[model samples]
Target: MNEESRTNIGTPVPDASNPEEVREQVERTRDELGRTVEALAAKADVKAQAKEKTAAAKEQASEKAALMADQLRAKAEQATQLVKDKTPDPVLEKTAQAAAHVRETATRAGQYAAERAPDPLLENAGKAASFARANRNQLLAGGALLAAFLLVRRGRGRR
Candidate 1:
């Protein structure tokens, strides 16, 4: 046997009389095919890993958005609740009652003054007129003070 034939013992001899060489060729082809399959599997695994990471990131972003929306909704609800709490039916009713009382008192005082000073030229006419003017000023000052007090009270109550 020559050197080439010795070195090519387990490979295909390319001669029809070599059954062992043909079997070795078949085994070598199987090993090469297995290696190719392993390489393809590694590429597939990398692609699958990339897809999983993308899916995870998308899921996390969606969760974060949902959480933010929920927080905003909760804040809005709290603000609405605060507004509702600050506005009361009783306070409005009291303010209206106070205004009505002031109007009724002023009207009654005007009528009393008119009845007491029926004649413009009667005795003590000047004094009565001066008293009426002073009374009106007092009523106006009292009304202004009361209104300011109510406004301050209402503002504080809201806070």
Candidate 2:
């Protein structure tokens, strides 16, 4: 490697015969160098790259968790259906009777309480019961979700 050749490795060598051509070449070289520096700086930014990777990983994990929850819900529904299908007709009838009895007992208890409780407390309890009746489906779904979460946590603890 001769000294001149080594020194001129990257430096632009424009035509000295035309000042205009030399100026254009220098401008082109400067633009190219600016682009190169920007690319190198992006590559060297470790924090930015790590942040990008973390965001992608978090998105992927969220998607996977959602998919898993959907699968678990489907499986639980299937299990419930299977159990219902396998239960005897007489057992189902007996269960329904027991549920009816429980409802009757609860109603009797509520009436007794309403007779003895303060008017304001009774009014509040009536409102709460009305709300419970109005939002039964939502309340049941929330309770089921809480139960499922507890069951899963318990199962993990056992493991």
Candidate 3:
């Protein structure tokens, strides 16, 4: 509301007979039309709008990734703290020693079993293994058939 433009706001249209006034009016109309076109053009800028949407999506993804990373870190820290609290150094050492003992025992038992097998028994086992390998598909199908028959027989027995 400047005093000057305020007066122009209510100014009546000049007579069409005046060439200069008509020209000025047309120029003003052209300026207003250009401004309207510019506004519409800005609104209709699909590439810019798409870029804005993509940036927003990327920002959201980054925020989510950061949040997930923070949660994972917190969970890992909590798990570490819980493990530290529940298992003292002596307990951990004993657990490790127990695991090693079990592993060693299993290895010794396997070795003993292998050593105690008779030559005939080992040879028979090897021949069976070779045969099974050569007829893997047939063996699998036969095993499946046997399993199905057993299941059916058991079901009948139950009734």
Candidate 4:
């Protein structure tokens, strides 16, 4: 084709002089149109847009939950410190002694149970104890928080 007749890059103009060239151009235009239609249809799809929004919301919610968990852990530590500060040293020592006695009793009971309990029960108890040991810090913090809350409530009632 002459440079004068050509337009938009090397794309040929549809003319009667070359039927084959016109056919090729028509096919190319149809392919381009089909792709454009598909892009528009995808943009118009409600379900796909909804799914994208839901994924973004879930990611945001997960981030917020992680942040909240960290804050809660910090607060638990502070509550535990406050409890330790308020308690008398003699009371603390007595509490520790009582805890040791309880531990000794538990050890003897566990030994007796090991001798007579079924294998499945012992296995489950072992798993529970393992989990408790692994999460001892968290457990202690929780217990301290509960104790602080109860003390606050009792003090308020006395007033």
Candidate 5:
């Protein structure tokens, strides 16, 4: 409200006395209004805003992951200490023996299975190739449809 502070730094308010001045002012205002609308629209874009939020979330998650690991390590240490303090010597010995037995059994079984199933990956791949060859027409049709759908969506996105 102070006269000393008042200055015409922006577009002036239209005075209706001059018709040409009013029209010029109206046009200027429309241009400004259009720009304002465009800026607002850009700000309100949900996908862009979501992407910004997702990036912020990913950054925070990466920062928190280190903290989470430290917390888990602390918890694991506490659990181990508690177990050592509470468990009986006899029970611990039995548990260790049981774990050893399980490991031995698993190792022997794995060796037996591996002996029986040599070249598993190659065999499975051969079977897969045979199945695909048998169903080539259906697979090709499905692939073409998927490709067309993706291409159409990509075209629409570019527009």
Candidate 6:
């Protein structure tokens, strides 16, 4: 081989006057561009896989949260029903009846004390009855006033 030909052996030598060589070069460039596009497509596929994993994680978290909310709602409903079912209604009624009986007995004792005593003993008894009546009225009025004050304070606090 001649020295110049040997030096140019592997170098691209476009035949500027030949349309076929230009077409061949264009075809080779197109193949290289296709390889670059394929590499970019591979990178895009990896990014899409990451996005899909993130979306799946979000969907799973949302499903778990909804399931937890449903369980909490069911437990709250069960607790409310249990409270309603367990109340002691018969015991409350008996307690009310016993309180009424005690009131009646006290009234009878007061009436008997007024009726059976002598005049001198009756005067002392009358004074005691008057004091008892005044004390009862004061206690009732104080209790009512305290209840009203507490109710008013509670109402204001809620607001």
Model 2 TM-score, all chains together: 0.58
| Candidate 6 colliding pairs | none
C-alpha local distance difference test of each model: 0.70, 0.77, 0.71, 0.80, 0.70, 0.70
lDDT of 2 by residue, 57-123 (tens): 9999999999999998788667666555665565556555655686699799999998899999999
lDDT of 4 by residue, 50-114 (tens): 99999999999999999999999899778778777877665556556655786799899999999
lDDT of 1 by residue, 14-70 (tens): 555788877777788899989999998978898888998999999999999999999
Q: Which stretches of candidate 2 lie over 4 Å from their true place?
A: 1-4, 7-14, 18-21, 110-159
Estimate candidate 6's RMSD in Å.
Answer: 24.0
lDDT, residue 65, candidate 3 = 100
Of candidate 1, the 10-residue stretch with the lowest lDDT total is 137-146
Misplaced by over 4 Å in model 6 are 1-44, 90-159
Regions more than 4 Å wrong, model 1: 1-44, 88-159
Q: Give the per-residue lDDT of model 5 (tens digit) for 23-110.
A: 9988988999999999999898999999999999999999899999999878866655665556556555655565568669966875
Sorted by TM-score, highest first, which candidate order results?
A: 4, 2, 5, 3, 6, 1
Give the clashing residue pairs of candidate 1, or none. Answer: none
Worst 10 residues of 4 by lDDT: 140-149
Per candidate, the number of residue pairs that clash is 0, 0, 0, 0, 0, 0
User: TM-score per candidate, in order?
Assistant: 0.30, 0.58, 0.40, 0.63, 0.40, 0.31
Least lDDT summed over 10 consecutive residues: which range in candidate 5? Answer: 139-148
lDDT of 3 by residue, 88-122 (tens): 46555555565568669966875786799888877
